[model samples]
Target chain A: MTAQQTLWSLKAGERCEIIGYDTTLAEAYRIRLMEFGFHPGERVTCLQAPAFGAPKVYQVSATVFSLDDDVAAYVQVRLEPRDA
Target chain B: MSKVILVGSPNSGKSMLFNRLTGLNQKVANFPGITVDVGTGRIQAMPERTLMDFPGTYSLQPISAEEKLAVGYFERALQDPEVDHVLCVIDATRLEKSLLFTLQVIRDCQRFGKPVTVLANMIDVLDNHGLELDVDGLAQTLQTPVVPLSGRSGKGVDELLASLRNPVMPDTNGAFANAPDALLRGEAHALSRRFGPGGELLVRGQARLDSFFLHSVTGGISFFLIMYLLFQSIFTWAAPVMDAVESSLGWMADALVPLLGNQVARDFTADALFGGVGAFLVFVPQIFVLTFIIGLLEDSGYMARAALICHKPLRLFGLTGKSFIPMLSGVACAIPAIYAARAIDSPRKRLLTYMAIPLMPCSARLPVYTLLIAAFIPAETALGGLIGWQGLAMFGIYFFGMFIGLLIAGLVSRTAEDRYTDLPFVLELPPYRMPGFKPLLRNAWNRSRHFVTKAGKVIFAVTMLIWILGYFPNYGADLGESWLGQVGHWVEPLFRPLGLDWRYGVAIFTSFAAREVFVGTLGTIFGIEGADENMVPLVDHIHASGLALGSGLALLVFFAISLQCVSTLAILAKESQSRSLTLKMFIGYFLLAYVAAVAVYQLTNALVA
Candidate 1:
């Protein structure tokens, strides 16, 4: 498996497993992300990248949330292998 | 009365369930954070019990002002002696994320020794998609009663009520109760994985819709089209109804005036009540249309996506995307728009949004805009009459108002005071559902009625005051010598820079009660000023009076930027929780409006010359 990439770096349709939070993330925001079901080891899929690409939608635990790139950068994830 | 607090994540159908259980028509939208105010109503079956609906939040830990508000209220309610039960609603289709919030709520309720019930809402969504949740197994795992129901279909409502009758507190020895705060997330994740619906079916269905809605090209185009439809509907659809209202009021006035024996009462009925208040009523239909269209956008889950689309552009203005909803609602009225601003996460952006709302050229401005445009601007059409010049002028004024709002918001948000402590932009996109027409109609009806009840009394009072002040002393013989005219003359120099006469000055002065009163005040002033043998429309009166093009344009600009509504100022004070901020904005906008009006009047006069 490759090293962690920020959730914002994943392309649409890319599937990834949450690894952990980047230490640089604000404490309050990190807690909020986790409470929104972005806990480590939880899987999420990139749903859509809106126009201009500041905020992107992602689905985790059947919940869809649009997070601005700044917020998305705090969530570390490992990309899943593409099915052939 | 025993209070039952309804708590849940945003867009979890919490408000809808509140409505179903209590039968109160509190606003529910697919967009999160619509319930910025606390809503309380008695349970339909049990009149003795009162249900409190709090704004939805992700967890007990809050990220925004409104979320903090909801959490604070919930924690406080748990300590209150009158509180009996807490219903933690979790979307069944989206179990894990919701369970995270549910766990926090259960833990909190346990700490307070208050009963908690896990309402597994939107199960019907799961059923239709051929999925299932083991409610009983989930109940056993959490050691709390889990009742499955749908807020949309009213399915399982009876079961929910039955469970409510004997609410049970989470067992003190339950797994979650003893689990530390950090561990509750994992427990919720594990429990949902075990008892949640087997597949990713719900996400798949919603993702299909998001593909088109969030696409770069189609999304932007649809967003503009929908917004244009919203703006256009307010004027185009409401035009006929406005005309009917105007004609009916005129008909009523014509029929009733002769029956009055006294001349003073006759003129009062005709000029004050009908001319002033009745003219204001003509624009109420526009408010109805605006509310209905906004409600449609909100309930369809498109408001969040619109915010997403607007986020980048709005960011350039030092505002976030959530500001879009309130700013657009401002186009309808500022009172609800101010309430809507609570949803914005950032304090600075919310303040900027408040500054921008009053400048949105609301429906109250429509009458003055229409009257002025008809008087000064030509009704000639271009493109084979498909586009009237008057319509183009209207668009220009509306755009100008919004542009000025954005400009001021952009400027103020960049100041040093607002530089620190900004909240992150995080919004949920709830799955799209067909908007409930019944609720939409009810909400629209309530909004219109609210506008009338709240603003109506003010308009009525101002009308009477203007009538008595203008009608007496000469008894409709000469308006120039009447009491209102005397006051108008006193204020005339203030408006002299805008090239307006005393009559316009009086109307402007009286309009501080509400912007729409500008029209009614003008109607009364003109009715007394002309004292015409035949009834003439207010637009023609402006034309016949030969109002300067500069003055007409100046009046439009003045109304566009001024913070004139007393209700808006009151709400601004209440919501911002700062009377001083309200005072500053009120004074600041009026000065800005005066300077802008003077500039417009000079520029138009110079260009024409």
Candidate 2:
């Protein structure tokens, strides 16, 4: 999946596992993602992606963080199915 | 006596280690030509030995101004005759980067012929991560002894002290003895290249975490929730402790009043000394709690993350993300918060941050806000009870300060034409570890001690001065009838539109010394003799007093943004080294406060009536 497509596709509060990055756009993606603790095999839960399309808040481990929309568009994630 | 200097990166638990060694016998004084205080403490390792805790710094080649002070000290120490041993403290988890500085110090020692040792602190954290260092190998490589110690646990501290007592000379001719000139030149390159694989994985792990927390939508909501919890904790948890302090002061005042018997002495002791200053002392619990949380954020490395997250929003006001740390700290006390701005590198950005910092509703303003908000605004939630309106109002006050700060920063940048130099925004997000007890307690105690000692002296004198002014001339009559009363009355007209009486005028005037004095001043004016029962519920007090709602709201708005901290301004002046800039800041904030208060009062009164 494309980086931008992966981010835009996630619903708020949805859990997703990061399998790996596509190395084609890796360097720019790596530097941007490093600041937020995103990496291979890490799971991320999106807390907020506002309707007006602003930056989103996320929970990785114990620490809570905020990232702008432009920066958030660089990450790819495998969406997890919701439990009924 | 040989002096041992303890040095490390900022927030590397150096101060906690210092406290462990020396206990309460430490003295913190400002380094010459800088506002950063050099904490000196005598640790008697032997009958005839002492150790000194040098202020923390990131590098020998200074990037920020405070780090430059450390560099300058090293340069000066080379020529000074009284110097002795150097104890370099390194964070075990981040040993690779810290070792770079360690290497620099070793190189300096090799050149200058000074004795040196390395203490690998936070070893416990390293062991937990399943990482083991070859200390003996490191020791041999650097030609200096390496002792693994935990500052929090007191483990290996005595052994480290013993090593310091019986100093070992480093081999000047060793392989690591020579300055790694190439290594120093290509430090960042070396960091990424040597540790790239593992570091990349770590970076990726951290990025995954950031993607979740730093999301714009969720980040903002989480930020507000965190802040709400902080405020609620300060208000609810600190109340009982505050009461205990108030009750103790009441007991002391009662005990002393009978012993003195003289009315002048009695009144001075009860009203001037205890009533004025004692009232603020009760809030120390809240202040400590706030400081502890802030210190935890800083120590755990989450604070920098918070700063980075908020950077863009703050930058809209022409501030860097780093400015948020100091501004967040300003909520606790502006004195340290202003000093905390030392972390921000750009002169213009630092000054702008400092100028707007006091606008953050500090603990000193809490009593006043609580009094006003309780009296005026009913406890109602905003947006379908997702959050309390009172909490939102409190949040709005913070948002207002940040807004004004950004507005002022933007205007200043536009008018001054000073280029905003952006420093590389690199902060280490150390793995989350439970902040250890000794370090946490020691930090809280030392900070409280600093607050009680340095700021306390000024607060005590100011509180006394306010008491003497408001108490005497109006001796038998109401304060409105005294000489100070008359002066307040003349100023009263200026504030009348905002709904403040002469009594309120006197309180506001006194509050400039310290904002918490507003509580004491009101208590004294209302003839509440003791500190314990000084604050009547805000609604009851205001309703009974017949203050127009518009006036109360206006007064609330005024206190919200007013620069009532003289100590904060003094620190800002010292930090920036410009009296004119300090004066400009003071005038600008005060003028903005007055104008905003008047506008709010007028608009609200017109709308309601």
Candidate 3:
């Protein structure tokens, strides 16, 4: 089963495909996210969730990017199958 | 001469490629804005061709101040008649993101009718991982010459040089230049998916390291240890060289002072040249050691991870993770740190960073701290000699200064009017690599030379003036009767509450020119005072004078808090563009330093009593 959720919902080592950004996300941030290759259909993997509420690291479109939880919450994604 | 603009995203090895092409030791930091000034150098292969290394940027749209500066200069250079070509450097391993920026550059170059070449950097990493990128396909798709090269390994650089001889313009029709950015973004994504390296090779390697570096337990432990080591190394590693410089200066004074026939000339040579400027020269090695360690952190890409770790805590102080770079750079010197502040996206955070930078325990403060600590703090070791008391004292004062800076930032950011909203904390974590020692050593040497040639002149002039003023009339017989003594006594009351006499009062005033001048001024004063006929080090002179420990500690506190350099004030005025802000900071810090020094002085004396 496929579930749609915010990118922040993905735990460490989880995989997802970009769907779109939330409508509530500001235009400036949306454009920047898109410029960073977070467009629809892009694949992302959660590489790390640093302790004490530090920004999490994610692999977006083959490049690593660190985003705070608030910004990550705006990126909508669909869960991808886990590797064996 | 034909000019080429070198542009790329931050951490794409663009600066390294510039070094490879031009053979210049232009700094390449893991973070952005290492090229705050446009560095121009002739290409090593074709001396007639000049390359301009612009500051790195993520997008042509320009978000941060540095990006805006880069994009602005890039656009203006495209219009300049002398400009010939635009070379866009990209990391082949992270092809998709690099292509996102490359696509924008290509689109912009098309609009400007300028020829563009795509230099795909860092293929050595790809080769090690056995990943592949289709250079020809990428070139065919973009209609620009794609030269894949390893900036670190110098592979494919000859081909890049050859390609530069006959640069090609985009063969696209007029319609391509008008494509919307959104459409170009989609096209870049599609192109990378087809031609970029396949699978998860790059991210996996970075992730494995991040797991250890970003872990709650290990990361925290390593961070403190690394920071402690940085301060400790500055004192311990540089001590032997410092002593060598001291003894050599002593030998030179011994040989040179006797040769002078005239008594006045003998006193001037012994007091002003050797005693004053010579004392300042002993601390130069510490600046070299500081620069080397910081460069190691910067080149190895640990600076970015440190920034990431500092982000959450730094934000509470009304600064971003980005401010960490400038603040850390401030530990070396504040002038470049002010320039490095350009990378910070928000004006509000940038201003707060400026406020904190002057408070960082910079190398200029090193001489005074060493002098005072040697005079007051004992030379003892603990943990079976693993840690020296002097290094610990250095670390304590550094931490104390930084803590006070953060407190001031927190207070100011809370009370000040919010003009610009805060930008999100987005910092690029470049893949960790072993730092190239050649560039680090070269940069350290250059920094030491720069400190000497620039601040050395000022210290020399100040030393000469102090020597003349103290030597004249009574001719060093009675320092209390000298001209400088009279001037110093006039200001002595202002410093008396902090337990400083007139000689120190004079040195404190002279130090405003440069913080290192404090030691030189004191050296000259004591030399005129005839402290020792055999020329003891400044520490011994301070000890022989019987300066109270409380007064010594007070001086350390004062130097730590005060903003002493005139160049820093000048740059603060130019960067902040507000004379009032610079003046307010100068006055405010002085007042705060005075109050704190007096309190420390009283408290120390009370405890001792």
Candidate 1 per-residue lDDT over residues A1-84, each given as its tens digit: 865699999888888999988899998898888888888898888889765665999988878899998789888888998661
Q: Indicate the TM-score of model 3.
A: 0.82
lDDT of 1 by residue, B383-433 (tens): 888999989999999999999999998898877484324777878888888
Q: Comparing candidate 1 with candidate 3, which one achieves the higher DockQ? A: 1
Of 2 and 3, the candidate ranking higher by TM-score:
3
Count the clashes in each prediction.
0, 33, 0
Candidate 2 lDDT score at position B226: 73
**If the candidates were sorted by their DockQ against the true structure, best first, what order would they fall in?**
1, 3, 2
Ranking by lDDT: 1, 3, 2
DockQ score, prediction 3: 0.66
Each model's DockQ score? 0.74, 0.06, 0.66
Of the two candidates 1 and 2, the one with more favorable TM-score, higher being better, is: 1
Per-model lDDT? 0.82, 0.67, 0.80
lDDT of residue B379 for candidate 2: 87
Across B1-609, the per-residue lDDT of candidate 2 in tens digits comes to 556677876656687788778764677666555456666777844535455677665567664555567677876765455667888887665554465577778778767677788888877755655556567767766678888888888788987977876778656675555545445534422342343222233334565555555556665677678767766666677778988998999899999887996877888898777776676577567667766766676666566666666666676676767788678767766766775686675556787787668777787777787777767777887777998867777777767776776677777766766443433334444554456555555666666665665556666777676666666675635776666676787889878878888888877887787776677667656766542234564345557778887887787788888888655665566666667777887777778888999999999989998
User: Each candidate's TM vs. the true structure?
Assistant: 0.86, 0.73, 0.82
Model with the higher lDDT, candidate 1 or 2: 1
Error of 1 at A36 (Å): 1.1
